[model samples]
Target chain A: MRRLINRHPSRRMKILLGALPFILAVAIYAIAADARGADGPDKLMPGLNAITSAMSRLMFDIDRATGARLFWADTWASLARLGVGLGISAVIGLGLGVPVGFIPCLRALFEPFFAALSLIPPLAVLPILFILFGLGELSKTVLIVFGIAPFILRDVMLRVAEIPREQIVKAQTLGASSWQMILGLVLPQVFARLISSVRLSLGAAWLFVIAAEAITAEAGLGYRIFLVRRYLAMDVILPYVLWITLLAFAMDYALRQAHDAIPWTRFKEGG
Target chain B: MMAVIRLDNVSKSYGETVVLENVSLTIEDNEFLAVVGPSGAGKTTLLRMLLSQEAPSSGRILIDDAPIAAEPMPDRGVVFQRYSVLPHRTVIRNVMTGPEWLAAPFTGRVMGRARAALKSRARNMLDRVGLGDHATLYPAQLSGGQQQRLAIAQALMMNPKVLLLDEPFGALDPATRRAMHRLVLGLWAEHKMTVVMITHDLSEAFHLGTRVVAVEKRRHDPHAPHRYGSVITTDFDAKPRLARQIARAPA
Candidate 1:
């Protein structure tokens, strides 16, 4: 941040430049919302008051149907589903990727299949997942895992493959078994790439989960957005969109920090 | 008399593209054997075969009068022209990897007495290679010469019976190369391990090798230069300092 500020004209200028676009966006949104509201009180653009009221209502008001804070319920449900889905993806990606990249036998076995799999649009298989796994949490999680696992796997494989052959030879001469070579040499080196891949695929993971939830679900952020769409509740939708963005941003930032902290990865300083 | 390592009519090819053809060599224990040849003359291929990283298409490589195994063993240490050290590991850790990995097949952890013994051993090797002060630093932190030195130390840590060097000093500056030459000679004298070095530098081969072999393509037709692959063309004894040392020893 210090370097960033110094490279700009001044710290104050940097801060102003950073905030200007966002402030401009907010002002434009407010004006548009107000103008539409003025022309039609039932306009689709919900003014600040409408968003504030919706947020408060969503935060505090207990649903008569379930006696739960619907916003929190939706957030929790989506979070839990995504957590499990992405967890499975990381495991499959890291587990299969390193071996396939390092060993020619495994590469021949799995690489072509994954290469073909990655090409197939994940959304095209959504209906199949629902049919196979059935329309439950299982199907939703499966959709997300299917959506991002291939991407993560490919990223990890490429990273592992990029490790110089000389290093592999050196490891072999050091008396490392194939397993030990993978564990000690490849695993730690590919970790930062795995983190980067996970972050990259997070967007697609969210897309699949939200699409799955929108089609069918009892309680989720996506379900809530799609549910309120019938009522044209832009006030609820906008804040929810912002909340999701904020969550995704936080996750990306956290992954980036972890990537920076690793000294051996190509992302690290002097690397 | 049993030869420590032997190559019997070894031939290697990638489909039609032959690299090495019908090469026979015998390596006695404690001999410093150097191979010199032009690029594409199969010097690297020969070293790769001995490391068991590549297989000869025909004939065989034998160690201790038995056919060599498919996998590379810690009994043989190799230093490549480049990327011999894993950049992620610190110098000490890089040297210690052999012992730690060997221990893992049994203990799964190099701990208690084993870890201490390995550390001391690694430190000793590091000191021998003049990297005692930089043990905790990563390979990236070291200069190219220093990194190569560290690699040499790492290779020596397993007490390998055969030390194979593939132009290990090729990347160093001239002065550094000379220093490395002296260092390698000292290490060879102290350890008495059988060494096989593949080099393009004729001087390095002569300076270190007890025996030097030239791998050259025997052109069947002058018009068709690429028709034949590399075979042992010249096999001769080098300046034998080891012989002098043996003669001077009080028997």
Candidate 2:
């Protein structure tokens, strides 16, 4: 038989090759689930049917306690927290980053402080945040802000610093005031960079949100995962994990698409 | 001819290292002045002082007999060796930056008659520089020569009283360099703008410049070679001297 491995696949064949791994993974999972089910039907590794049914119940059925669909509620709650936290971080990032990058005095004042702050793991401060802000939405949101803001700020500062020496000279010679230089030249370029940095930090943002929610939350993807962990219902847990991964992937894809849609983002996209 | 700029007893040093020493010259209005020197001889240092990018350690630089300001302003346009045209903008917008910079905020959007006028002027400058069809292209899309042409167009849009070019065409191919030489000379003549240029090419210096000045370091004790900095070693009318050099050359 002619080996497909040694030869390049045609476009039609490439699609099948791409799907082959996913199909194999599902097949392996099914086989494992079956082997476990043969011995102990009430098992940790859930079969395909059990997972699908559990996913449907979690998504469609109204919870008896809240009279609300559980999955959608948790998803929206987590998304809301992440969105608000990252949004505030975007503002703080640009705010702190631009001045620190441009002004000598501000750079001297704040750079060392924040450079050290970024070194401390954000989760290490989670308990302190909870203690200070109490176990509420603020603490959860604050945790994410604390988690992602420093990284975003540092990235923005570096972006501003990368503005070439000649460009600055050229701008100044064009009769731009210092304020105009910063606002006009720096602001326009840095926002696209801000988005790219935020995308990278979104993984950490999700981690912080889930950690906060798992520790204390009324409803969230993280909260649900933690709540279901005690029973070892791999059915619900596996689907939830997959759903979060799917959501994160969708968000990352959306940001990349948004970045490409903008014309001047080539520089920001590169670094 | 009236003196458009004057540098008196200028010297620049950074800590123990000296760059320029005791340089003085009077630049007449609408005159093309080319400065040439070996590497690290402070040819660019002189232009920087004129552009207000740096201050002389001692002595004053006067423009049109008025002392130059501390900050660089659009009144003195410049094209550096590197293409100074913005990367993200189309050619027209890059050329339009000066007027837009003076008037527009950082929004990068312009509208109404002001925008139309700036665009019209930019288009005309681009056409003059042989980039008429390239207005929609960004800097990276253009060739090295084309990018230099765009940089020139951008600098000229402000219609500066003085144009300072720091080896602007050094990166272009010889053929492109010749074309840029023609373009620059054409603009210089048409605008009657004061031109202060730094160049390493001797033929270029003589071809375009009415006056040529060479900066070189004075001989020092071998042990104290760093003691003396570069000075304006030769400053003369280039027209007569260039005629002599060209006439005497073997064909």
Candidate 3:
């Protein structure tokens, strides 16, 4: 299996594989267009036409709108919410999870609570959140943080716990302190796993943010989606969904690249 | 020279299982001592007790005439049989971690001075291990011998007076193991550090250890049984020859 991946395909083969999906999509679109003549695109999907049109119109708006456009504004707002949420989660997760993971007693005491909390979806507690914080970015951001923190925390904790006891013993013999064991020895190895966990939890947090914003947001991409949905503007809804997905994709890609490009790649092989 | 470590009438057990019994040994400063035995012969258990990573159920362990109460001292360093090198750090970073941990916190001057000193010290040690060129490489990128060198470098980072090695080359192939043996000896001779190593390979113990101690099952009297018989330390010239000689010895 490794040999297969290592065997580099030629440029021509690469191009063919890269173009296959687009070629298929275009072929399908063309055939549908030809099948339905006058209102071919619409006729291709009678019920879904409004969705397609609404999406196209929203795309048009996003492209044409100039200063302080809602699209860009919502994008930035959603990104800000995600950033705050992910950052809070990262800090809190690592800070608490590492110690819990290192100490077995703490793990026994706290892991169950975290596990129980994680099982309850953050979205399910939206009413309580709305009652407390109302329809604001605070509620939505908090929702994202809650959604991701437990999952990320649990993963980081497990990774930390899995650090070989031998390594800890070695560090102890070397006269490393508790913090040194964590930062110099434990954290370095756990960082990669933690980063991966963050990435995984980021996707969950994004999903939760959208759900949260849909219910309690005055602004954000989810709010935009909600506003468009009120009038059955499928065009706007589709584009909003696309934007959210694109944002998630971009963030995830950026994270992976940053992780890969780190100079510490010299020390560690895999997360 | 005074004995850096002393274990007197030391006995250890896990629940009902007795691991080591009535074990007494003195490791002098600058001595390279190797404890060798068959698998589960309590050689590792003795090393663990000496390292202060584990406590004997009964008896006392002293380091520099002081009781080893908690973890081993800053003056003591250890290399494990595997993964002694932190995989996520650079080679130099792994070596420097010891000093950096010991340095003052939250001050630029302290950190800066420590960093410079660590860099120079780590480089010198890495060069000694013949790994100067691979300072930036991860342990995974290095060969078994090279990773062992990195592990050795990490142990030496603090200029420890005592270095504990637990089967350092146990996992290496014969050729790499032989090369590592030479490397360790050279390091020991240069550093003149006290080394207490555990090995299953009798030959390795004889070659590297100034005084090789053998741990093996002994006949128990059942009436007043001791878990371990007397550990016999031989001045084996070479580890491999020691293995052959032990094999020839009567049971």
User: By lDDT, who's the top model here?
Assistant: 1
lDDT of 1 by residue, B73-176 (tens): 77788998888888778889999998798889643248889799889989989999999999888887887789889888998887888899988988889999
Candidate 2's displacement at residue B144, Å, is 1.8
Q: Each candidate's chain B TM-score?
A: 0.93, 0.92, 0.84
After superposition, candidate 1 runs with Cα above 4 Å error: A1-16, A40-42, A100-104, A266-271, B1-3, B106-108, B220-225, B241-243, B246-251
Candidates 1 onward: DockQ, in order: 0.45, 0.43, 0.41
Q: Please provide the root mean square deviation of candidate 2 (C-alpha atoms, Å).
A: 4.4
Residue pairs clashing in model 3 are A54-A235, A55-A235, A266-B138, A267-B87, B203-B239, B203-B240, B207-B238, B207-B239
> Which candidate gets the maximum TM-score versus the true structure?
2
CA error at residue A125 for candidate 2, angstroms: 1.6
* Predicted candidate 3 versus true structure: per-residue lDDT over A133-228, tens digit per residue: 877877777788888998888898888978877778767656677766776666766777777788888778888877877766556788788876
Residue range A8-115, candidate 1, lDDT tens digits: 467889799999999999999999899888866644898999899999999899999988999999999998988899999999999999999889998999899999
Position B61, candidate 2: lDDT: 93
What DockQ does model 2 achieve? 0.43
Instruction: State how far residue B85 of model 2 sits from its true place (Å).
Output: 1.3
The model with the greater DockQ, 1 or 2, is 1
Q: Which of the CAPRI classes, incorrect, acceptable, medium or high, describes model 1?
A: acceptable
